[model samples]
Target: MAKVAVLGAGSWGTALSIVLADNQHEVRLWTHRTEQAKKINQTRRNDQYLDAVIPEAITAYSDLKQAIAGVTAVVFVVPTKAIREVARQVDPLISPETTIIHASKGIEPVTLKRVSQMIGEELTAFKEEEIVVLSGPSHAEEVALRQPTTVTVSSVDPDRARLTQDLFINESFRVYTSPDVLGIELGGALKNIIALGAGISDGLGYGDNAKAALMTRGLAEIARLGTSLGANPLSFLGLPGVGDLIVTCTSVHSRNWRAGNLLGKGNKLEDVLEQMGMVVEGVRTVKAAYQFAKEQQVEMPITEGIYQVLFEGKQPKDVVGQLMSRNKRQEMDDLAQLLMERYSQ
Candidate 1:
């Protein structure tokens, strides 16, 4: 069996470590906190992050070198912001042959780089094809409970993605592969922004109709921006796209959606983030997407509206009005607009 290192011990990280352990692989699950690692090793209970018991095959470590040594693969589940630092620390510990997989979903606000890109930049020894992105609608809580879940892996090298597929796929966790790395990353990262919007809509007491419209149109904006960046528009239609959007927007497990729900209920951005006690990626994602939209001249009214609420201190109610008051567009099906001839390239 292949040995793997899973960085970060948060909900997502712990869940993925469980997947690896269940697959019977020797998993080195690393956390930055020494006390947490000791607790995990002693009790097999990552109580703060995952409610499920970590399998015996998985070992927790606070040392980066000990966790990565001789591992054939490394799974990065850290927050987007910590990706660079962790990757840099792991770079000297693992060989160039160690395949890198990242499930951290978000774009860097400064460089607007996807998590894989950040890893690639920091782990200068690993080539672009070595990086694989795993994303879909699966929630950490569900996955930890061994609930049936599906996710997709993407890379520049289809073979590499397929290899990752074999490592994680099991009866409870199904894995798929896609060639559209750009689209996969875009869909995964941006859906959190839409989910935040969905939460805001729910927070405002806008019934299903309002949320329906928001989700539908929010998808349009995602496809629009994704296609402009040269990602296959069809990727937005797959697991990484609409599948992810639906789960994150609708599920209570989604931190982004929950954060938006708090914002919708009149909490300030700082207050919402502080109260959640976990990283709300969509808050940062919206800002990056908004900046990218402006730079690319793409129309992302929903993202723009959310950005205003989160950063500009605009009221959620007022942003809703602004979104509704925007100029008209053709009522054509979003499918037509998203998959138009121009995006075929």
Candidate 2:
């Protein structure tokens, strides 16, 4: 069995460690906090993040070098903001043969880089194609419970993607592979923006019709931008795209959706964040995507509306009104444009 280091102690990281341990791999679950490491080792549980017990094959470590030493792969499950800092710390410690896999989903606010891109920028020891991304509709809470779930692994290198898929696949957890790294990352990141909008819609007491429309149009916006950035439009139809959108936008387990729900219920962003006590990735992704959309000249009214509500202090109901009252257009226009752009290249 391969030795794997999961560089984060959050729910997702812990859940993935459990999966690795179940698969008979040696797992090192690294947390920056020494107290957390001690607690996990003593209690065999990560009470703060996960409800399930950690497996015996999984060990917790506070030392970054020790956790990664001689490991075959390192999985990054940290927040988007922490990716670069962690990468920098791990760069000098990891061997060149170590496979890097990141499951964090969000774009860098200023650079608009995906998590893989951000990691690549910080870790010069590894090539860009060696970094694989693991993402889909699976939630940490459910995965921790050993619930049936499916996810996709994507990389520019086909062999690397397949290797990652093999590392994570099991009867309970199915893993698919894709070569459209750009599309996979974009789909995973951009869906959070729409999930926030969906939450806001629900909080405003809107019915299913409103959410349905938001999800559909939100996907269009995602494809528009993803295709513009050299991604395959068809990838947006896959697990990381539409599948992820449905789960994040509809589930109460979604931090982004919960944050937006609080905003729609008339709570301020600061208060919402304080209550949640976790990073709401959608808030940051909305800012990054809104700016990126403008730079790319892509139309993303829903994202723009969410940005206004979150940043410009626009009322959620008023934003919904603005969206519905916009000038009418053919429903298939976006798909047609996406098709033309994708095939023309």
Prediction 2 TM-score vs. true: 0.98
Q: Supply candidate 2's per-residue lDDT for 273.
A: 91
Off by over 4 Å in 1: 333-335, 342-345
lDDT of 2 by residue, 190-244 (tens): 9999999998898988889999999999999999999889988888989999999
Candidate 2 at residue 298, lDDT? 90
lDDT of each residue in 31-93, candidate 1, tens digit only: 999999999999989888778988999999998889988899999999998998888888778
Assess each prediction's global lDDT (C-alpha) against the native.
0.90, 0.92
> TM-scores for all candidates?
0.97, 0.98
lDDT for 312 in candidate 2 is 94
The number of clashing residue pairs in each candidate reads 0, 0
Candidate 2 CA-lDDT value: 0.92
